[model samples]
Target: MSAPDPLHDLGVRADADGGLLRLWSEHATAVELVVFAADDLDWAIDRVAAERDEHGVWRARSARLVPGAHYGVRVDGPAGPAHAFNPVHTLLDPYATGLARADDGSWRGVALAPLDAPADRVYEAAARPPAPRIPLDRTVVYEAHVRGFSRRNPAVPAELRGTYAGLAHDASIEHLTRLGVTTVELLPVHAFVSEERLVRQGRPNYWGYNTLAFFAPHAPYATTDAQAAGPAAVRDEFAAMVDGLHRAGLEVVLDVVYNHTAEEGRHGPTFSFRGIDNAGYYRHGVDGEYFDTTGCGNTLDFGGEPARRLVLDSMRYWAGEVGVDGFRLDLAATLGRDEDGGFDAEHPLLRAMLDDPVIGATKLIAEPWDVGPGGWQTGNFPAGFTEWNDRYRDRMRDFWLSDLRRERETGSAGSGIGRFATRLAGSANTFAQERGPLASLNFITAHDGFTLADLTAYDVKHNEGNGEDNRDGTDANRSYNHGVEGRTDDPEILAARRRSIRNLLGTLLLSAGVPMLTAGDEVGRSQAGNNNAYCHDSELTWLDWSWGEDARRLLATARHLIRLRAENPALRPVRYGVFGETTPSATQMDWYNADGATMTIDDWNSPAERTLQYLAASTPETEGPNRILLVVHAHEAPTEVVLPAHDGVDRYVLLWDSAAESPDADDAPGAPASETRPAESRPGERVGVAAQSMRLYRAEGAR
Candidate 1:
């Protein structure tokens, strides 16, 4: 038996003699660097045994360790599940800047870590594309999966389909630009490994929240040629993609999952973090067992310096090297946990990110909770950080799904318009005034749950496609199908579905806080009622770009709504302050209902009342005082609500109507709805909104 090497002790040096790359396998008695020929697929021309340093790091300096060379590490040591020290197995190099895939569907480490693949190849650092960095106040995030986004685009090149290049193509860029989203927050792009269990079941981990290497972009997304060229090529392709997207004027934000690793349970793979320093990297029980904070098997001990550094370094790498504009930290509360294994709002990692100059301007959004104690941190994050407002999701769901359903079934709408109004005004009670309304990243549908279509098409989740029966996802989903579940050719039901979707999208775009629209929602993408379609890497989950008339209408409506939000700064108020013009604006909101009267507390509690009206007047504050009136009626029977003319405002104009096939041009700022005063609710003209619809009117001559 030979002595083990201190893996971390070895140092890498680059000079005229090619470049030196090393992996420290402290417990491994022997380490071999397997270098593959750059032009050949099936051969490695060189094998050099790595010498060990006192700290147990394996080191080797050779002309063969050049930048373009592909390589892997084979380590021999005490064998274990958490520590698979195999001598014969060619392991992917942890520090390999480039990687490739073998015939066996496994990643092959690239020895030459740069795209050019030469000893003298100058390594260019990753850079941010020249995209506009939209302010937090104006951001409307579109959460999308990279592959799914491009897979169905016919305009994209066949060879580039489902690749980073495809996403960067003019077709994809044009779609986004037309959609009017300033930022595209992609699902995890970091390197991820499919769960062995799922692989055996013939499904891949498509959502990619399960990260294998935080520093590496997922290789599968690169072009086939790039993948063949190895990790460096893959990286270059990704960088080029971001640069292309930036040039198109859209910012790229990442959905980063740092709370846990792909190293699942205690029997997971020996990836970099686990093998490098198990005890120092992961949170453990009293007897040195794993503590699962993320419910993803093992949690990173962010309290430990090594684990903290890993996260911080990864963030810096993506922001600085990868040119990402911002990050939405998955289970962010876990990163703020203290040494005692409890969450701390002032954790060093949080403080450091807040203070880091390079990443300071980048948007920092928190998922805000974990599976650990006190995990639901909602508004608990420090100021300057925005959080995904789950409360907003629930309330909106209630308004359009539950409350709407309750209104139809029981002939009454429970809950006050005030609650919905609060969320619309950015939930002042939940988020602080200093943090402003933008602190709430309001969303109705996300990657984890039902699509906007399914939210109104299915009452319960159908996750059978996930291969987990139906028990895997959240059962407390607050969704509602107007009359029938799943798909139906019934015209009436179909019309209702469209109306519900319009309602949800309208609320999301018009809400006071920042809005995040899940991709495919605007295009009527459905997962066949499967809310948890995380594993289906097929068309069932991808956006069907082949335009249907209804889908096109929805897309157009969404675009107009987004443009409205961008043009009307008053819609995105930073704060709902005192009812005046200076400093604190966005406070001039008036509430009314059918019969044209201010809503009283009794009106809110009355279930019989299913109609309401709202007029938002933005004062001449930093944002604005643009005024618009919205009327909503959720009734099975057609009812006309009297138009409430404001005190100093006369002649209401029509700007938009959900029931209309398209937005009325007269619905623009100058040309409002009808000025006929809604005909005084004449003989059943109660301001007739169909069974379920919303209408908006812009009025002039403010009081």
Candidate 2:
């Protein structure tokens, strides 16, 4: 077998006696470990020359390099087309667990003391009460920014607001639990800094995608006390937060950025990777120009051994040492690119991640695309990975929003219920048979796009506040403002908008794939029509807990929809069904038109025919047999639909109405039990459906 990998343990490690520093550089002629004075970071107290081993790893040791010592590495290497090496440049360790900004505006690594107990024991103790390990079919993910999530919550302490502790506060947990989401997917928490361009423009990179350090918790996100107490304290606070969330039965998922670093283009700052070994760390063209895949200026060379080791190590640290239950990989397509810059389904790094015992147990999600050539790889990831389904988001938006706009302006919807129906049943055409519907992560809105309320209130993006002259966000919003754009006092317009919210929410929760809800969508939050609000950190991005009557109604409707999804097995399927055969955990679907007969090919593809009755019966392996009937009418005008008659069904009970202001008049708990009047209806009976509405009914078989 080949020699063991020397890149392992490639950062500062403290022990009872002293500390050891390991740096990896294939081309370095000389590497030195420079120790700085704690009082004056710019003053180097001592420098020890590191010896290079056969495996290209430079190693050094010192008693002065003990815990809390500030240090950096200086490497001298031959300069060439693919390299940008400077002997005097002090580079931060790539695997630095703690970092400190020096007085000269540079960075230094801080050696952290050994924990009171073993790292695994500490993490396990902190993660007491444990994650509920909610099944993928039963999981509902709520994506939120850690700072924006509890920043404005009046119940959270003022000092703790906008911090990790704030998110673990009782008020925040209560809101999430009451909303019925099982997991909270947080935006990037890796230590990041504002981009050079944004810093020059007096703005900040609010989304935290520009990762500066992979193994460190962002110090600024902690309370002032924690920040002042240093990196160890910051880490403790983060651990406490995870423990609190786990105790409350809510899982935490982190949005991880590994495709690119904070270091931008060729002329960008030489902080860590660039100063150490540019050629070995980053992707570059033969002519020495950076191959910027991901559109973030520089892409990490995943094909390189050292780079792959770094990513795998960081993931292991986060999953085992920190208590996160899952990860959402940003710009994941870049991670699968080979040395030739071509996409590979079984890339070494990707396979390593799936096979690694430590990282493989946790949930893995991929954004599945980047800005590079041939970057859209949706439904093309490995078996255990779930990918964000942009197709689902687009088609749902088109059917409900853009189609409505076309119907009013051109007297045609421009599409039919066929495409929408396929998506509702989990986009079988998109994902593979073995992977099934769970491979598709469905969402109508996310942190990078327009809120659900804005989708029904704005036809075009109003991004003037983004300082790009309304050109910063995507123009293909697929949104409609009913009859008017922006805010309007017209009661009819307001009513239609509210109904649209209910319809979209219902579609997301009742679909066959995993649903991800943007944090504030349940309360009808809007970004003032700004589809891209990545730069804003003020009240514009925070979740406003205070709500009006309409918003409250929307929140109530969301809770009811989630409950319905939990109670109905026909809505969430683990596998696709085969015709004339039963499959465990699969849904057998039937389609019909307004006349109650089996749907014709014309009904599926005709744009003018936008109404359909969907009947689904679940062949559950563990749960009870269940069935549901969904009536969809997307036309601008009302339609009368005749319920379809099936052999085993006798009555249809009304479960939910998207057209109603509330789920039920009295809002009684548990499946609208009292509203069973329209509940008991014989097949072939005609029901009046409002314009652009969805009606759900529970089918009761003969008993």
Candidate 3:
């Protein structure tokens, strides 16, 4: 009745007797399966002609398609501008679960036995731990890389460092669990290759944004044992990493690049999709020139059935078979673009992905923008998706860094606290009401930008090592140097920078939306002012675990702040409160000025009024009823402020303060961060808040 779905069973399906390989190609005249000898990859052992079925899907069967068989396809078609068929250039299967490079630098697909088995059997409940299934509100995402996370760590064994297995090591688990983050968001683990330009310059794509295959785990991330054992073993190692994190009550979210492949521009190499059906798989112009939108070459034509199905199928395999908890779609705006290359919130592919049964349960984070025309769809994604809120990032940075720099030069902060207050309360203007605050994945620093320490130490990007004549990387750093660029020995400047770092960290964790911390920010990791270090695989990008007392203090402060957020449900509201109606899981907010009076228009908009107190009380649903008070002073001058007097609130107990150098000495992992004894005060009592500092308190209820 329905012309049997053409993309179904589109990859190798094997058994003991033989195997069947099916591939979809609209323009190809013939398809031949080429099986190579296991010992010698260049030696072809069997060649079978494939039969083209009615739906344009070509099918071929052979006993050689069994597990561990090295194979490829040679497609032949008439020469045309819209066609690129080379029967001699054996192309990889678009749905390959494993890949291997040949002697001549060409690519071939490898058949793995586990791929044909039932998904449940491959990842049994006992062998593979269950997903943490952490709710959006409780999620604290620590964005780290597989290699950079453990490469320089002394705790990890020498041989296992920089491998997937290393991330599952006891040391790694202890570090993550102690940090209080619920999720570990990793950089792309999908199989990728360096860009053609980076390759020529003898540099590596350390960030792994350039993907070659969506289904295959990047084999290089596996330890020597896994790699030597073969592709299936490599995947099992990845699974073990996930299992370890899950056992520690941590979830894993992968950064996926389905927007573009490693195949660069029109003149680039003929890899899997480009060689299979160039015009059908990628967006192209009239004369076959690629419609490059992802900036790293051609964009996948998500409008087409086969191309869309490719991404969906890959996601299903990873989520169901591999047991990954979630995915963060890199440059995801391209996925929402239609046939005409226009971004649509209601794109068929986007809707389908949100509704898919397997992946729907998993967290789907969208980078939410691309380098294409009309590609900045930050707040316009579908309801089910959570987006990287760039507005929130820029606003927070401007308030804490750029605006501070402006104040020092112009004697006045350029903007008021209105915007900053909005972001701190959950960016209701950016995301929809139905989606609530959880729709925004808030982060000031990501893998693509400068490290947290660099933001306080560097005034501009230092990317001279990238071989792009320093022309690469973004120029809008929104960073401050505190009277010195790079590192400084000035005690005053150093103290100021440390306080600023704490302020940024405090704002990020205490903010209403879900927070994502870059890997080594807790220990004050710096990149030597290099804002974009994507091309560097050296120690420059690897996180150095060796740090002195300052870093240790910073880590303690981060842990304390994270614990406070976990205990105070008012700080992590799931919904926005209505005017008078109390919404469950929402926070009822009250704003006050320096005089402890209700905030008026002038107090909210005037740059001169830099101090304000925020009182948030949770309309409890899952957690207990909670209330907290947060005082913020933006100017670099000590000020005395009266605490707000609210109904049911009698006194305030201090939780954390950015004014302090760091957390107390005993505020370590097992330490109780009790009120610094003398810090508690009654409502309406004036308290001294240090310059450019913030204070958090638990509002002790009288009722």
Candidate 4:
């Protein structure tokens, strides 16, 4: 009907003999494919002229373009305000499946032959099985770095430590399986390079956000053998890791960075996108200045079809070929911005990702914001995508940490439990009713901020090591140090911090939304007050396997809380409850004050009234009918709460308590499921809630 899109198959594709190469550049007057010697990348063996089609795609084919051959493209184009095309500059193919560094310090793309049988196929043939496809409601995500996760693990082999294989190691799988997280959201594994500035400063971009190539896995993260074996081997290792995790019933979710590129500012680098089509690949002002929304130098121009297709292709490769279960998009708001740079809910790229058959079926979670204007789009993503709820993080922290600090310093907490309760029951005011609670990926602490332990132990961020002279990280951490900052020998302070950790973990795992736990938070890992530890690949950022007494206790408590959440269907509602009607999979919640009486509007807003009781009953759809009562006290001062009397409930069994030093006995880390059964109490029974703690009770009713 119409001219076929030249962007289709825009990379090297193997045929029966040689290979076909396609390159896209609207401004390029001439394009040439340069093949390098296999042994010496710096030496060019041949240059083949490429013929341009009507769709601006330049095509060429050569027997030398077979697998393992190194190549790059040279484009001749008109230079102007928005364009940075250079005829002499050697550029990488945007869709390069593999990349390599030459001895001369330049980069080239390695041609990969189409797999006769995909590695995932071979993996399947081995009967490794596939992902469990854990339901969204039942998914508990554990966010970790592939390298940092196993770097310090004692059980992982020395050579395998800090590699993709390390994560697939039996010990690592066992640890994750034992921890009870259904999904593992790994930080970026895309091919990335340290920022020019970070490299010059003798530091590296530890988080791998500076993506160089979207389709390729970071080769350095693979084992030495894989790295020596080449890109295809690296990819095989990555696939094997996914297969291993899948066999363990763990879903692997990649944290992808499509918003920006490693080719930073105009003067930064002449890599793939920049040298190929700078203006078309990056968002820029009228004067050719970059419109940097990602705060990472250059933002990818999602407004262009080529750029959008690049992301879609990358996603399809990972989801289909690699067998990952999901993706957590970094700086996702940038992907939704239109040509005019305004945030649009129905941007073509966003819609395409949600509608694409392969990617749409997988879980898509958005970080939902960038550093640009109108950046805070927490609940603004479309129906199919779940967004990281920063509002929930702030409110929970404020009520538990900052509010408690205010009470100690100003004689009154700054806010009531109203906002906290909204998040607890699911932020109906934020997310659309159709999207429901699952749309909210609720977490109090993420990789970018303080750990759960730091949230209770640090009043200020200590980010001097980031080379920004303590000016880097966000000042508004919303954290309190519990009378002393950093490490403290004070028993009272230590006990208070432990209680705060329990409360935070309890709230997150018990909340009515998808929960994401930062990897080492369960073990009380701290960045030593450094909220922004993105530059540190050392022990500071790695998850330490060695656990102290407090860390062990906290880990056990976390496991117990996660288990409790799985057992109680009322805690995880699929939909928001209507005020006067029963909705399937929705939780009908009733609010009460310390006196067990219904809460008044005044009580909800009063700063002095910091204690409240919540009773939730689940309208069963797939699970049995369930009811639970949660008591929340937000002040340092102890309070007595009267358990609310519900129509169908007769007695309440104590399920979990945050005030307990350990979840079980002092000697035992986690209490057995049977031992967690405390004495049952009748309605109106008074229970002493310790300072700044939460308690959960399962309501048993007379049938």
Candidate 5:
């Protein structure tokens, strides 16, 4: 047929005797393979010339390319506006399965030992737990930083603290299992380096978005013993960590930054991608200037075949080799940009991500936007991918925090209850009917924003420590400090803040979509209003193990909410219900005003209409028939709501109450499986709903 694809078997294909190294650099004229001395990376042991094929792939065979060998490639090419091939600068293989840093801080491709597939599948209780392929509809993501998660936890061993092993420790696993989260979405674990600006400022890139190498696990995240043992050992430790999480039935989802590399802006550094093929790897104008949609300086040109393949290969490796269950593509809009420099839902790389069997079979989630034009693609991603619902986040924050503040200032909130109700019922107007509610990965707080507690205590971002003088984070933070800024001794103020947090959490779990909880939010963790705490790897970012009475109550509330979500099928719908036709696996919704009557247009739009009731009954496909009635009150004043009357429904059992201090409160429901039962209510029952709070009830009946 046609010429064989040179991209096939890229990276090192090694065995004991020797191996072949294939690298793609379209602009390079001469590519040379340099093998460094195993003991001393500075010393070169072998230099071999590579021959380029028609596809611009340079190939070289070396016995030195076996397991544990250290090597770098030196490329020389024509000096042009688009080309920056440096013969002196040693560049890492784009397809490197591993990476290592030299004493002088230069990086080389690590030739890690091949993993044993047979051994990996053997699950002798805890040896290598199989991946828990939980369905997307049932997935509950708990986003956490690998290092920060257990760094400050006293229960984790000192030696293992802040490492991948630390996150996989038994104590760490127990905490997640107890909290009832199904998936652990860790921040970028990809081998990353500090941005040149942060490095100069003597701060670290704590979030790991500045990816150095996509395929290699961050060596620093491995234990000291694993780090010294080299990249292969680091990978083993990472795999073990995944296995441990799997043992606890927790899926590991990595926040992967494939949109850009650690090689920042034009003046930044020449580590790997730049030295080899700057013109080809990065998106550039006709004059060779970079187009940075990622906000990370150099955006990896997924428009190119080689660059697109790079991402596919990385996914295959991480999913197939290291055992990651899913990936939350960071600034994913960059990945969808085509050769024409416009984002397309069906962009080749994006399509390949879902079409490729190895990656497509696993869960795929997208952050869905970047800093590029038309970048706010909130619900624009394809059906198979779940997008981080920023709209949901903003609306929830606004309804509870900002709207309440507006009510206090002008006696009227800017918005009515209509939009909030839409978000709470999974934003059918935002996501497509085919994708349904699950496509909306709803969250009130993520790693990038203020914690749940901070959202109610800070009116403005306090990010002076980020070195940008409070100019780094988003100013459009829909947050409100109640009566006073920061912490206060006012019990009423504190009580109000706690009630708001509970309301936000209740809305998130009872909503008709997959929910992602920021790791420390359940326990009211605060960064003291530092919304952009991306630089400091200190106590401000870590998940603290210790908690006071308030934090413990919040934790119990979160657990109960999660348990309620798992038990009630109506709360999480797989399909958006059609008005008249009953869609299988969908939720039939009925909206009611505070008077228990069908909500009129005025009732939905009026600023005074702060009270609404949502009744969702699931048209079950796999699960048994289920229905939930949620009462929402956003006004500062306490109000009474009449429970909506439904046909053949006897009474509603109070499953949860935001006004209740904790889930164990007499009126509120605890876990579904718990022996303690909740209070019951009849149709048209007038219930007292607290200021800015919600009450969830199970509609018990056989219609």
Candidate 6:
């Protein structure tokens, strides 16, 4: 109300007016902005009664909104779940970039006028600044939640554990670096509101997917020092985390949920955007009713100009202000829908992301589909973007799990060598040549589903702890428990599971496209059967640093596989070459069966043939210095297959064998197993693959 008011320094800035604050409470009979002294949290100097407009908006102009000032909004009105307006309750401003929680869990908003805080200066002034933007071609993405990644680590300090600074600690970085992923794809870190049910149960949304403020980092993940610094401090800490990751040469990609907000239907809380402009921001039914796309209450309507601006502005803020290297847009198809409800690949929001100069270099990946009608847009995204390849997930699962189960139980294999070869070579059939192989973001496991370990250790999803009566999580998991369900001490069963993990990892790393590995998958982390650990914040979600012998072995195997992927150009193909003929700069991938002959159509559609040999030779013009051959055997029984002995190649080398207790040293490819394959061999003379495993070979001299 007077000169030097923190509100003047902290409030929103406008060209004409110095600072401004707006309240979005339609049911409130009265609303007042209460500004408090910085040092004394309990006392307030004055209250500014809001001026309501024709649209029921309440706003006040003042220069007192500066950093360090404490404030809250006191609204007088109705109270209940559907009608949440308590005049006695002094609510924290939902738009407060900074927050300080009181003893009672209520927050004191930061002083307002400082829109141009110190944190904002550092972000806008910094140039290139060494942020790691790993190319999708050579990327091995490790998906994780910031808090869950460090919560269980003993090496990280107790107080900092599960916080943003905690994740940037050397202990966590060392673990990820040792595991060998180029990018750490973090789950949603945007500010979010916990569901009332979760709060009552004393549980928080561990995944943080229900975003409340797209521009603000969730304050809980910040350290005490950061939290005390207010919103500016939280922003600085987040930027510092990105700086640390970039210094370590690891890219930071975010799993963004722009499809929906924390607002749950019409009954949800009045938080941020929903309270700011509900009717204009959210998509609704024909009669200006409820939103139906997200099933999670409400979906953001990208159909409108103002909504599109909000989305584009948020994206730019994260990419430029927060300094994220890339983004994986959740339920992206929902963002492409028009007012008439038709999805457009060239939607204005999507186009702006592709063309925005400030953030154009940032990697753009789409979850590709939504729960809406005509939502399955798999390979339909425009060029310059990548998509999560769910088809590849199912196919790979069927190849190693379901197919191997059929082989063991019925003494007959399922599926073919040809289709398996396509997945290995980037699933060109699914993505066109123009969009190229990078169009596919391939993965066998994701955060929403089972880990690679569980994919082979559990046949059915065990999600009893989710409190959803097992109705939650996906049932079409395409998994195989491999002889025994859950944990088992049986030596044979344990050995099979290990091999299966290696096989899956091998397939993922060896496949052409951008590969995303779920956090803890490298070390064989399990959710104890809970596929959707969205709410459980304990060990169910944390990455366990202390691992057993099998987990350690899997970690080593994963590292070796990632190194192999990085070194081999053939494995990270950006373009889809001619399948039947040679194409420049692209390797011609060939397929064969146990009988040592080219695969036919019958071999593919048949649910009886599970073994395949994959041969890839670079085109003569663009062969460069890398060439290799990879073979896969998806069977329970030991099978001896002859090498092709192509006219040019005389011998081959063994680079890796998933069946081996450990990865074997390099060996020539085409030569007989007894001759060139000189690594530790099993009792049998044939190249034996413990059921549900894969192996890689490199071709040498020409015959």
* Count of residue pairs whose backbone atoms collide, per candidate: 32, 1, 0, 0, 0, 47
- Give stretches of model 3 more than 4 Å off: 1-3, 115-126, 666-678
Instruction: Give the per-residue lDDT of model 6 (tens digit) for 170-224.
Output: 9989988887898988899888878767777777888877887666788888888
Q: Over the stretch 204-247, how does candidate 4's per-residue lDDT look in tens digits?
A: 89999999898889999999988998887888788889888998
Structure candidate 5, residue pairs in collision: none
Better of 2 and 3 by TM-score: 3
Task: Judge candidate 6 against the unseen true structure and give its global Cα lDDT, from 0 to 1.
Answer: 0.74
lDDT for every model?
0.76, 0.88, 0.88, 0.89, 0.88, 0.74
- Candidate 5: tens digits of C-alpha lDDT, residues 672-692: 437576678899889888888
Compose the digit string of candidate 1's lDDT tens values, residues 411-443. Answer: 666665667777888888888778878889999
Error of 1 at 47 (Å): 7.8
Identify the superior model by lDDT, candidate 1 or candidate 3. 3
Stretches of candidate 1 exceeding 4 Å from the true structure: 1-63, 71-96, 101-129, 579-581, 584-587, 605-610, 619-624, 645-648, 664-688
Candidate 2 local lDDT, 504-609, one digit each (tens): 9999998999999999999999899999888899999999988898888888889989988989999999998889988889899999998888999988888888
The Cα RMSD of model 5 versus the native structure comes to: 2.1
RMSD in order of candidates? 5.3, 2.1, 2.1, 1.9, 2.1, 5.8
Which residue pairs collide, candidate 3?
Answer: none
Whose TM-score is higher: candidate 5's or candidate 6's?
Answer: 5
10 residues in a row with least lDDT, candidate 1 = 676-685
Residue 334 C-alpha lDDT in model 6? 90
Q: TM-scores for all candidates?
A: 0.87, 0.96, 0.97, 0.97, 0.97, 0.86
Tens-digit lDDT string for candidate 3 (1-703): 6766667988998976778899999888889999999878788998999999887899999988887788999998878777788888989888888888889888788887663355533335455667889989989999999999999889999878999989999998899889899999999999999988888999999999999888789999999988887787788788878888888889999999999999888888888787788878989888988888888878899988888999899899888877888899999999998878899999988898889999888999999999899989888998888899999889988898998999999999888889999999999999989889999999999998889899999989999999988898899989998999988799999999998999999999999999999999999999998888999998998888898999988998998899988989999998888888879899999999988999999888898887889999996777778999999999988999999899999999888888776667543122343543535689989988889989998898874
Q: How does model 4 score by TM-score? A: 0.97
